[model samples]
Target: MNAEPPPPAPQWAVPPEGGWTADDLDTLPTLPPHTELIDGSPVFACPQTVFHSRAVSFFSGHLLSSAPPGLEPVARFTIDIDRSNRPEPDVVVVRANAVESLRQTRFPASNVLLAIEVVSNDSVTRDRETKPVKYARAKIPHYWRVENHDGRAVVYVFELEPATGAYTSTGIFHDRMKVSVPFPVDLDLSAIAPRPRAADPQ
Candidate 1:
């Protein structure tokens, strides 16, 4: 008979109470410039490419520029749910007063009204799978995905349904479409797309 496979090796499990403490979080490898600890596992953030960065900048700038009174735009900061689960959404819109308080530390989930992810080729799976589940678990009210490829943006809007711990699809906006939600303003897709630039000569 073949020998038993070492009792099947103990499976790793996420810690109860607090997933990871600050000290344990500090010991993780620091490379690739940006990584987040999700349930004590290191999840690498997608690297900033030109188009990806542009999409983030465009939408962030638009939100900041057009935000109504009391609303503000936040970018690339960890929104801590607990020690083990801190996700740094690409863009977050929260109350202006809350933004001021979060400057001193990680933004609490209560302050987050909307979370946006600008999907890159490398992060599509994590954004669509891991993150949505995490955000849904956290009860974030709204989530948006801005998908870019060959210079176009495809927007997906999801509204969290508290009863089911999932996001119910609200809308899907393609090129040149507008998205209007409960948030203070409407989002025009054209504003988030790449614009024409003068060609470089040889």
Candidate 2:
């Protein structure tokens, strides 16, 4: 006799009223791709455009290579802010010393030095409006938003206002970006231009 085939994963298995937590998310047998738990509900991450991936790759490489001692950049990692908010930033700069203390899959907001978001058409409201407020309230020291405009990458850098727990826009970069806050970083943004894809064979 042939062996039985494995069962397919449940289409919908949200927990009963209380909502999904990080612990519950970990217990899921299989999660859909590009998924994030939002306020105890699962929200699929926005699909990435080719340009988006290239920009992230470029920024990650640049930031990691030049990061100050005891700090490093992490991409596509979840930050546990609270029961209601656990956003996975596109990239985050975190303290090296706290890497071990973070849960196997997620970091606490307190450990994050900076949180970054690469804006997608579908995520403009969330990235530009919603998440910034959340990160600022979480007391993250810095936040960066990257978007392309007029055929060039634009970076909006923000710093936290400790008293208000809000972010103040510090610098906006259109070409070569130079800043000294949290740490000094000098970056060239030319590679952020969207590349042309080869035409498919007819």
Candidate 3:
């Protein structure tokens, strides 16, 4: 007799009356890690690529070092944009005081000064279109979208316009990146490329 195949994995079901809230994200053990809430729905993150991982690290390190006295950089944390939306940007520059608790998994959007997203094959729509609108409407002042261009990182920066509550592109940077809003930032984008490991000592 042939061996039986394993039972299908369990699935998470949405509630009957309404979609998920930001608070539900904290309690849902069945959901995948790094899941985000958008428009009352759960948005799962696709597997990250090598380029995505390297770029996230690059931005986190540089932003942390470059942040001013009252601001700080945090990586892979969700921002509580509202009760219904809690999108996790790749990196966020937030007010230092917002990190009051070590156990906190999410920060309020009001405390976020800048949000950065490293585009992957699966995140193009959210990173390029959806999240920016939400981030701006929430009054997060700065946003950066990093894309892999010809095996190199290119950054597109945006700043929120207070009156209209929307983001306007500040610059598109390749090879190097420099900006002066929400605290000065200057980065060498080329460093995001992987360097060859030194030959093992003979």
Instruction: Output the lDDT of residue 139, model 2.
Output: 93
Q: For model 3, where is the 10-residue window of minimal lDDT?
A: 8-17
Q: Which residue pairs collide in model 2, if any?
A: none
TM-score winner between candidates 2 and 3? 3
Per-residue lDDT tens digits of candidate 2, residues 3-110?
899886564364657777766556666776656676677767767886678778988888899898999798888888888577888899999876885557888899
User: Backbone collision count in every prediction?
Assistant: 0, 0, 0
In the range 1-202, model 3's lDDT, one tens digit per residue, is 9999997653445443567889988887678889999988888888888899999999899878878788889999999988889999999999999999999999999999899999998899999999999999899999999999988999999999888889998899999888888877788999998888899998
- TM-score for each predicted model, relative to the true structure: 0.77, 0.86, 0.91
Q: Order the numbered candidates by TM-score, best leading.
A: 3, 2, 1
Looking at candidate 3, what is the lDDT of residue 45? Answer: 85
* lDDT of every model, 2 decimals: 0.73, 0.83, 0.90
Q: Which candidate has the highest lDDT of all? A: 3
Consecutive 10-residue window with the lowest summed lDDT within model 2: 8-17
Q: Which stretches of candidate 2 lie over 4 Å from their true place?
A: 1-15, 101-103, 195-202
